[model samples]
Target: MSGLLALLDDVAAIAKVAAASVDDVAGMAAKAGTKAAGVVIDDAAVTPKYVHGFEGKRELPIIWKITKGSLFNKLVVLLPAAMLMNAFAPWLITPLLMLGGAYLSFEGAEKIFHRLFPHADHEVEEDMDVGDPVHLEEARVRGAIKTDFILSAEIMTITLAAIPEGAFWMEAVTLALVAVAITAAVYGSVALIVKMDDIGLFMAATARTGFGRSLGTGLVKGMPKLMVFLSTVGTAAMLWVGGSIIIHGLDVLGWPVLYDTIHRWAEAVAHGVSEGLAGLAAWATSALSYGIFGLAFGMILIPLVTRVIGPVWSVLTGGSKPAAH
Candidate 1:
């Protein structure tokens, strides 16, 4: 009886430890998820455009497919690679993160470039009209998944960095929690954004009161504006997060001039302002400077990317395999 009681006590102690670990993982995942907000917003913003021009029936199906691909990217491909990075080449994470930051900056600048030089955009009409839509969906889905892999990689890396180093199991569980939470948040939000119009239409048709019907009508009209807002927010987030990453990464790498200079200048400018507002002003100024830097670097890379890198890569691969396996 005493031996059995001792074993029971040991089992209870083990269960308590397990429960604590679960709580730790959940806590880390939520905190880390918040850190990846920029990418999450961009993901939600960017996905709806892929569904554009598809028949209504196909839109949800496409989203579902892409969502699955995203899950696979995070869970199957990215999670394992990130684990290896942590295990073997932990030092490389910051530089890899910085490179991804540059990518976000480049994309953000490219969006600005498009707005400033709309004529330069090679419209996708021809590509959209590919003879076999089945093939097109597959291609688009493949492209989106590849894109998601990059963004998700960036997100996961940021999450991993945010978390404290614990036992291997602790880190693994934390990452898994982050992966599942982020995937759910990004795609769930995307689904809601995509389906709001349909929901509004249903409400408009079925609502009993004039106000309810008008509210539904308003929701129908509001979706486009919401999308525009989402895009604007996404672009801003990309710039902010990208620039912040570059600054933070440089600091971590011991090249701190750009990072310090921006803060110093912002603080100097903010001194005349109210104490509470001063911090806000300084932060905004620093962010703006970083964002401008990101934009300049991105714009410079764009031409090089298109003219030199694109052609060379195309020659090497025999087609545009930029996002191909």
Candidate 2:
């Protein structure tokens, strides 16, 4: 009887430990997810444009396809690569992250350039030419997945860095959790944002009550403005996050002038504010500084990318125009 009791106690203790590990993984994952919020926001903001102009029936399916691709990107591709980096070339992480940050800055800046100059989008024009809906959907999904891969790389690296030192299994578990949760959150939000117009129309037509109909109408009208707002926010986020990464990377690489300068300026600004508002002021100042740097860097890369890289990429790809970021 005592032997059985001892065995049962051992089993119970093992279960307790397992439960505690689960909690730890969850907690760490949440913290890491927050650390990657900038990329997450950009991911969410950027995804909806892929579904734009698609029929209502196809929106969710396209989102589902992209979500699956994003999961594959994170789990099969980036997660393993990140683990390898952690194991063998942890030092490479910051430089690679800065490269990704530069890419983000370039993309965000390109959008602004297009807005200002109003160039024709060849990719969109090609999509319009594809008569088959299936083909068009496939193309868009592929493009979105490609975009997701880069953003996912940023997110995974950031998350990996955020996790506290632990067992290999624990780090793996934390990263996996971050991957699944962030993918679900990003694509889930995209799905809703894309389909919101349809939902609003349905509600406006089906609702019997006058107030319900008005609310539904409001939703339908509001969606366009909301999309614009999300796009603007996403661009700002990309610039801010990208710039912040470069600054942090510079500091890590022993070039701390820009980072320290920004810090000092932020501190000075904070000191001038009321205690309750000081933190907010400091953060805003830092973000603004980062954003300024990001924009400048992005502007410098734009001409080189379009004039040199784009043409080279086109030739290598057998004359296919490069996809717009």
Q: Estimate each model's TM-score.
A: 0.91, 0.94
Stretches of candidate 2 off by over 4 Å are: 128-130
Residue pairs with backbone atoms closer than 3 Å in model 1 (clashes):
none
Against the reference, the lDDT scores of all candidates come to: 0.84, 0.88
Candidate 1 regions off by >4 Å?
265-282, 321-325
Q: Pick the lDDT winner.
A: 2
Which digits, one per residue and each the tens of the lDDT, describe model 1 over residues 1-325?
Answer: 9999999999999999999988988888888888788888999898876776667788889888998998898888888999999999999989988998888888888888878887533334544565677888887777788789889999989988888889898888888888888888888888788888988999999999999899999999999999989988888888888888888899999999998898888989799789989988987898789788888778887887768887898899786635411
Q: How close is candidate 2 to the true structure, as a TM-score?
A: 0.94
* Deviation (Å) of 293 in candidate 1: 2.4
Q: Write the per-residue lDDT of candidate 2 for residues 57-143, one digit (tens) a residue.
A: 888999999999999999999998899889999999889889988988888888788889998877667765646788888888998
